[model samples]
Target: MITAPLPLDEDLRLRSLKRLEILDSEPEEAFDRIARLAAWAFKVPIVLVSLVDEDRQWFKARHGLATCETPRSVSFCAHAVFSKRMLVVEDALDDERFLDNPLVLGAPHIRFYAGAPLLLADGQVAGTLCLIDTVPRSFDPHDAEVLAGYAQLVERELEVRSQLIRLQTAHERDRRSLAISEARFTTVFKETPVGNALVDLDGRFLDVNQAFCAIVGYSEDTLRTLTFAKVTHPDDLAEDLALVAELLAGKHTAYAMEKRYMRPDGTAIWVSLAVTLVRDAAGVPLHLIAAVQDIDSRKKSEKALRNYHVELEERVRERTAELRRSRDALQTITDNLPALIAVVDRDLRYRFNNEAFRRVFGTPSVALRGASIQDTLSPEVFESLQPLFARALAGERVTCNEVRYRADEERVWCTTYIPAEREGKVTGFYVMSHDVTEQRRTEQRLREKALIDPLTGLANRRALQEELGAILTHVGAVALFFIDLDGFKGINDRFGHDTGDALLREVARRLAATVRAGDMVSRLGGDEFVVVSRGVADAPGAERIAQALCHALARPFVAGGTIVEASASVGVVLRGTGDAARSVRMHDTLALADAAMYEAKRAGRNTWRLARHTAADKVKLNETRYPAEKAKSNAKKHSEF
Candidate 1:
């Protein structure tokens, strides 16, 4: 027997596969369900989602197989990966390459085989979605097409899982970065040379750093209980209070002045005081950041040289230099932050903005200041955000998500509006926006993948449950048809699973086509299907639907170039006359319909049974048959088969 040859890019391909970090991972339901559906579709006893490693082909998801992996030398999937396409072996025993392969000769005893290579986004073949059987069978082009479709589903699942892993990794990295940033801020605040303190709106000190405690000649604990007003000299108190009132009134964000502080000994020392109001995202004042620098020596020197113009000029230069240094430090911090932040006054003009705000809007800081919001933003974007801005101006905190285009690429931004209040009146608002495009896309992918049946492109059982619950809660009357395919097992046994899967897909299509536009049709796994019909007024209307479904299934289907016949055994349950439907549980209705389906099978195949709810809330079954002419036509078609 010949072993599969390695591709020219074997090392690169293996590296790409290992990068997914899925080689030896635990089984995921997302993958396992795909395997199960492929098994049911192909009517194969063994199906696997195989990932080819350096020395082995490992099964990430396996159905009808116990072993987790096999040596690459004996793996059929390895050959499929090497070929980078669908590989079909009608009879492994007759094929010279696999005739002596251990998997072909021993346990599992593979004869017929089909493998579809799984390709990643970068065009690297990781492994294969393979079907194995113990007996020889032919695989047609249609069979190959079905296998390819299932393979694509496996690829999508891999992409989604990989994307989730990457996203999680990014989240962890961001968390670490955030923790580091907070630590740096704490260090900077505590170790700065200037005296810094956090004061509340009521003039009470919330926190004071070491420099502040030294300047005030008070312990940090002793200062916490005292208000800034208590430490200020009485002569300077009125002016300081007026400046604070103006700060809170949103007339300015910050103010600076030479002020005198009274120490415990009643001695007054001059200080250069800078106060900035800190507001939350909602534009409400949270606290005040005060930086005080002891300037007693400078004040004394200024008094001694009051008549000297040169001395006065020198002092002015020194003070200006210190203020520039403080402004530069604050600017450095704001520019490093990733989020876009800006302050807008009540007239919708920009008052202040961070570096990120300028970068995102492509405007310089000088251009952005005092610019109207409407002029700074595109007409479309301004129109969309006008109401949110108005809401903030009206003292309402608002948050919304928006889709915007920049550099011809679409992005999602989460923006929050915080109203700044001055004496109970709104004076301005703060805007903070973050990009969330990737996050939104990931959530959307997860949602879509969860609700759809990858094999048939129909809604799965979960979607059916949700739809059923919604219908029962709102609709007056509804009918549920539980359909089980008749004589399906015989077709699978005769024509192989490939043919059986094709037939199942055809059945799903026919079932969908037989229902009304608003009717819901879903596959409940294997050969079972369900159709939900809303606004069915009576049993006759429900019966007509069931009959139509049975007749649709009764028609002969050509799968894998062979004529095959199958019929439907439908069990129907009709619920509600009006609001009474809300009282019926989804599970109870489904259970009754399932039981009635069994009764239809027991009565005879190719017919339907109606399950009616009695006054006692128990179910009573009534058998129904097709019209005589339709029954005769079905019989004649079966006879031809």
Candidate 2:
């Protein structure tokens, strides 16, 4: 038998093949249809659009073939690439080169082959468009011509695909450059100190900066879901609408005003708004660019000065008409304030201090005029407050609450630091402190009373539901155990209420101790409780937790000298790492777990049962401890349970 010789232009042929860049790509419907058509036209069992690489013949499209490629040395397409025209073997059994070929002798058992070499524009053969038959057949001149026409169509499609790929590569490079430019512009838009918004001509928010979100007390995501008209103050909305109409009508290119924006919590804030119209190249109205400066504090200060002026006018009529004396009277009013107010420079030295501030620090205003906080406060206290000062200096308005011990009494003081800006640069900060010890203590006690269970000291049912709802919002695996104390009512009837309460407390302690630290146990009303655990992997992880909880509760309880004993029936629902796990709701999970608990009780109490809220198996009991003897013995025990 003779082997097929390689073409003299083999290196150039491989270069042309590599230039197509079609290897190892996902199959496209365009190429797949061509292969299917070729197989049907040639009346052959198999047809392949194969490309020969250095070591292998990779199929771009194949019909009726399980493998994607074969060794190049043994490939029928490899032999066909040696000729410019179609190659036909009437009978491979009679052909010297293919008589001992494994493809003709074993699997596929090709006895007839017809292939037209796929020639590129560079006049080099890349591979073939081949047809194969299990039985020997003869191909006439007409068949060869028809096959060659199909091969030309395949080559034309390959060239088009290569051009499309190159164009796509160039387009992707342009897209990436545009994205980088957009990202840099977006960073500046989001982080700028002045509030900025991109709004459509219809007054809908296209994008908003973080400063704008903070000013309106709405998140960036929430603002995008609303129109600017929705957040405008009701009294000011009509005027804002008129201004926008004028802008859209080409009456004004820009406008500025001091307007009010309504916050989410129903509070109004004043802002200095500067709006400019953006237009397309053809002068069509595109969007409105709005820049907002928060001016609430300035507005408040102006109002206060106006009131002081009115009072000064009344004083002039009632007492002296001297201007210098009116100023002295005004200073006296500020000095007598109950709240401690002071202004400190960037160096943390006092620029000005009110009489109230001096009294609180137990220093006279004349001596404390230019003193630093380090002079009055200990090193430890100064260090503790340094970070807050630093944050204020960084242009953040910060509020802090601190406890101060004065002799035998402790007082809580709320201090707010407002950064003072001069010409867009931070110069100093204003400080105000007021006592809020009683109010803070009352709030803390109220919060604890609302969240903690009165009896078990565990979290109540409300907190448990909240925790479960939070987990459902984020995607993760979670397992819930619904535990019901079995035969607790019998103990309450026989041993009395006091003994039952003791057993409940002990059970709560044991349940808390049985789970991981990240897990939460809650008392859901009477004898029912729930445990919500996160980071649990699959059904087996949940089953292990259920088994541990059963063992913890299976221990005996001694209460009120009656030696009360009770066990728990637990049902576990696991949200495994499956496709639909994240979409499951808290209530649905609870209902399924509750149903499984009843199944556990029906399965003769104290043994845990698993249920499918996920893709896992349903109604499965613990595998390690299914007792055939105990099942028969206690089959009728919990029939009423």
Candidate 3:
């Protein structure tokens, strides 16, 4: 077999493929859906989104194929990538390049192959979105265009994944930087010479540095129990209280003054104090951050020290405002996205949510924040999602399809959970969900169209094959009835095509009504119909069903104001015993039934014949004829069987 040579830009192409970070990753539904759709559209046995690596061609998404990868040397997709275009092989046996290929000679037996090369954003070929068939078939230009369109979809999904990875990398880098910044701030707070404390609006200390505890001459726990008012000198209390009130009232953001603190020994020490009020996003006061420096040694330098403290407080306020603006901007971007996005902490409480999430769940921002997941979602939904949440919290990235019924309408969602990890532990998880209701409905409709006969609304030929295959797996006796209407062509020739169609519909209805509830009825195109009945006890039981069906269609059908008389010529096959039954495949049974049908037609029509398998695995026919007297009496009214 001829192997494909590597492209001149092989190194660059490999680099681009690696940059996607998609090789050997778990299959994603988005990619799997594209592969399934391509297979369905092409009616091929296999479809794959193959990414060509240096040593192997890996399947990112595969349908109807069991293996995950194949060697790159004999890979058809590698050639497609190297050529940077679609490759089509109508018949591998006829093509010299693939005639000796292992895939063509062995399992899966590739005969017809078509691949559309997947191109990355950088113009490097990754691989192909390919279709494979065991039989040789011709592909027209339109088919190529369709394949190319599917390839484009794969490229787009790859691009989206690449962008998401890049974004996550940037986010992780930013988080590490923030952690470093916090670490530095913590070191400064604990080890700095100047005293620093975080105080609530009521003047109680929420937290204090070691320097603050030393300056106050009290332990950290002791300072937490005492309010600033209780520790301030009696002479300085009124002025300090006045300045705090003005800060709360927004008269000024920061205030600096000389204050005296009465220590445990009742000795007062003068200090320069700078206090700044910190507000939330809505400009509500949250806390007061204070910095104290000893001014007892040089009381004359109080003004200079106060000015320095005031400037420092102003810088702190500006930094706080800048961080808030950045946070608001990020929130805005997330809020406008179509996907419902949320972050849930380890406790299963919502730590963050986007506007889309709030709207979808019908919860307000204030109510949703810090709300338990169980409380935010309905009981049923919460229960259904609990396992997924647990898996994500256990550090598994999960993707699943969820269906919900709301107000009598079915809504489908595709959801993904990505764990947030810090220091080798899962701290939280991110939720992203997209509404896929329309897409799922469309797929359902397509499936229905494929299986149901549009004209008669009965199971079609394809459906019959699938059902028969399943029925043959069991050991029970099965009877297959192949019915052909006697003189359907004459009726069609005389009454016109429209009346013929109406008559066929009437026949289909009668056949369906004649069969048992467990039986299956199908129309196999062009005036032929089939019925499959399972659990039959013997050949007589099978004959009885065929007779009933023949009798049902023997009745006259009135269509388009024209009365048309038609009778059925049915060929029935009863599944045989022992080794013979095992050897009788679905098609073999169908052929036997079809041959018996012709026997009934030759036996004069309006009759049924049964075919059974012999020990030699050959079909033997048994004819069951109608009574001569009954045939004579109904000869003019109905055709003889």
Q: All candidates' lDDT scores? A: 0.80, 0.76, 0.82
Best by lDDT: 3
TM-score rank order: 1, 3, 2
TM-score of 1: 0.45
Clashes of 2: 0
lDDT score for residue 430 of model 2: 86
The collision pairs in model 1 are 42-497, 282-418, 282-419
The segments of candidate 3 whose C-alpha lies over 4 angstroms from its true place after superposition are: 93-96, 163-191, 238-255, 278-287, 295-315, 322-641
The residue-by-residue lDDT of candidate 1 on 1-641, one tens digit each, is 89999999999999889879998898899899999999999999999999999999999999999999999989888899998988999999899999999998898999999999999988999999999999999999999999999999999998997798889999999997767455434533554445778899999999887878888898899899999999999999999999999988878767889888999998988898878776554457777878787885445334222222222222222333443244443454345555677789989998877788666777876678899988887788888889999999998999887747264667788889999898989999988787779757864774676966766766789989998888777746678999988877778889999999888888888887777645778888877898987656567668878888988999899877888988989999998665555667888788778767766777787899888776555545653333236456545534433
Error of 3 at 628 (Å): 99
Better of 1 and 2 by lDDT: 1
**Quick one: RMSD of model 1?**
31.3
For residues 326-385, could you state the per-residue lDDT of candidate 3 as single tens digits?
444335545655577788999999887888866677776557879998887778888888
Question: lDDT, candidate 2, residue 439?
Answer: 58
> Candidate 2: minimum summed lDDT over ten consecutive residues — where?
315-324
Provide the clashing-pair count of each candidate structure.
Answer: 3, 0, 4
Task: Single out the weakest 10-residue window by summed lDDT for candidate 3.
Answer: 632-641
lDDT of 2 by residue, 391-457 (tens): 9999999888784624346777788899999999999998888777875786467467686677887
